[model samples]
Target: MTRSAASVPTFPGSTILGQFARSLISLAKAFKDRREVRNLAEFDERMLKDIGLTRSDVTSALAEPIHHHPSWVLVRCVGRPAEAHKMTAAHKPRPVVPLASRV
Candidate 1:
């Protein structure tokens, strides 16, 4: 009989520590997201509209649970020229090097 690496049982102590680490990471992410949403609240109505958001939308997002991602609303908004350029840059494929030259 063959056993794959995935079949190995995890140590109970390590499992507990891993879960604790994940919780800490999640808490940190929630804090950062809440801060970003608060910053967005400072934008005036016209600026919000330009970003395809209403003042009400910002309010609603702020009211959501901290674990909820409010940035999704901003992501769905119309992209400014600068933002569009950033998106294009992010998606641009990396140049591939020949295997022989990699060494």
Candidate 2:
């Protein structure tokens, strides 16, 4: 390291770059949390107005595929309904012994 560069005061701790990166990550997470909080359409109308979003946006986002998920689930969404139908048919209960117990 240069002798002159070493003389600079470093806030008695970590660097501004490190601080900036940490702040950016923290901001990102905060936005993510806000998005999740907004997802719950259970919020009242006044609350929605305060957040500056409508119920439709939340409902529409719910329809969209989640960011991270199993690849097979994504395939299922893209593929023909025939596969889903067969899977459903195979799992369906017969009249004899149903998997669902009466509550």
Q: Tell me the alpha-carbon RMSD of every candidate.
A: 16.9, 14.0
- Backbone atom clashes (below 3 Å) for every candidate: 0, 0
Q: Rate residue 84 of model 2 by lDDT.
A: 74
For residues 15-101, write the lDDT of model 2, one tens digit per residue.
777898887886676556446644557887777556554565555545554442222332343343557779999999977865787
Summed over model 1, clashes come to: 0
Q: What lDDT score belongs to each candidate, Candidate 1 first?
A: 0.77, 0.57
Best by lDDT: 1
Clashing pairs in 1: none
